[model samples]
Target: MTTGAIIFMIIAMVTVWGGLAAAIVNLVRHPEASEAEPSPPVEL
Candidate 1:
C-alpha cells in the first residue's frame, strides 16, 4: 500500500477505536438511570 493509504488507515482506525473508548469511559462515569420517568397518559 502507499504511504498516504497507510496514514489514512491509521487515522481512521484510531478515530473509531478512540470513539469507542470514550463512550465506554463516559458510560462508566455516568451510568443510565435504573428507572425511567413515567410517560403521560395518551389522549384519544
Candidate 2:
C-alpha cells in the first residue's frame, strides 16, 4: 500500500480505538448506581 494509505489507516485506527478507550475509562471512573430506586410520584 501507499504511504498515504498507511498513514490514513493508522489515523483511523487511533481515532476509533482512542474513542473506545476514552469511553471505557470514563465509565470506569464514574459509574452509575443501577439499583437506586426512583422517587414516588407526588400528587398535586
Candidate lDDT (C-alpha), each: 0.95, 0.95
Clash counts per candidate, in order, are: 0, 0
lDDT of 2 at 22: 100
Query: lDDT tens digits, residues 1-44, model 1?
Result: 99999999999999999999999999999998867767689999
> Residue 30 in model 2: shift from native, Å?
0.6
Candidate 1 displacement at residue 15 in angstroms:
0.3
RMSD (Cα, Å) of model 1? 3.1
lDDT of 2 by residue, 1-44 (tens): 99999999999999999999999999999897877978789999
Model 1: CA > 4 A from native: 37-44
Model 2: colliding residue pairs: none
Error of 1 at 23 (Å): 0.3
> How much RMSD separates candidate 2 from the native structure?
4.5
